[model samples]
Target: MGALVTLELPDDSPIHDLPWIITFGPLGDDDEWEPVVCGPYERPHALALAESVVADEDLMAVVEPLLPRLSADEIRGEIAASRIAAEDDAVQTEDADIYGDYEDLLDDEPGPETVQQHAEARPAPSPEELRAGMARIADKLGNLSG
Candidate 1:
């Protein structure tokens, strides 16, 4: 069973009124967990929501058993793997600068312009769909608890 923890924030934009960052994790396999992000949100808000999800009684009940099996090194490795890599951008920029006037070199031959076809926008999920998804998550947690 997979666990989900979401952080949501309100926005004025009609396309995305409530943006969200969802952590779908604690999967039944060894795959690394990553957040499903949409719209715009602050880092602090995401952290707060994750903390709240961790503190939830039912979630904790489902997660507690898994905690004991994890070693400190494993936990650190997960953190390192999941963390964002802003540091790499600096290294990439430095490497590009190694070839003096590299930016000018690329301008010599501009690639052909490609036309992108935009897909038609779809409507948001119905309330029933949202409820069903939540119910499914609850069921997974319940099953794990037993």
Candidate 2:
């Protein structure tokens, strides 16, 4: 198994010397970091953190420009993508409150009553709607090259 590592600051470490990167997204209603990069950190650590985190649809990261690495356009694109993702998550949260847990109906030995309740609830978006939303997100993320 691969050894798990965390990028936390040393306990009570002074803030100035320990420059690090932060990757975060909106959770519930607040913004929060998913992974924090620190400790003798270099460009490689920032790259690795970015790679690990890009899988999340609504997060972005920033490290101090150790050597003027990222261009202005690149940073603008990242900001746009993160904003779009945050909007999507907000919509999804509202939808979930309305729809409840649709997947729960698929569990083993689900009661007929429960199934009926799910069936009667106003349905979530169709697959086509989901595809459309994805296309919109893709169109919004101009700087992200697949």
Best candidate per lDDT, number? Answer: 2
| Model 1 stretches with alpha carbons more than 4 Å out | 1-119
lDDT of 1: 0.46
Q: Name the 10 consecutive residues with the lowest summed lDDT in model 1.
A: 60-69
Candidate 2 whole-model C-alpha lDDT, 0 to 1:
0.52
What TM-score does candidate 2 get on C-alpha atoms? 0.27
Q: How close is candidate 1 to the true structure, as a TM-score?
A: 0.22
Please state the error at residue 127 of candidate 2 in Å. 42
lDDT of each: 0.46, 0.52
TM-score of each: 0.22, 0.27
lDDT of 1 by residue, 1-146 (tens): 22443324355534232223434344444443443333123344444555566564223112111121134465567677656454676678778887565565454776679899999856655657766865785577568747
Deviation of model 2 at 7, angstroms: 12
Q: Candidate 2, after superposition: displacement of residue 81 in Å?
A: 0.2
Enumerate residue pairs that collide in model 2: none
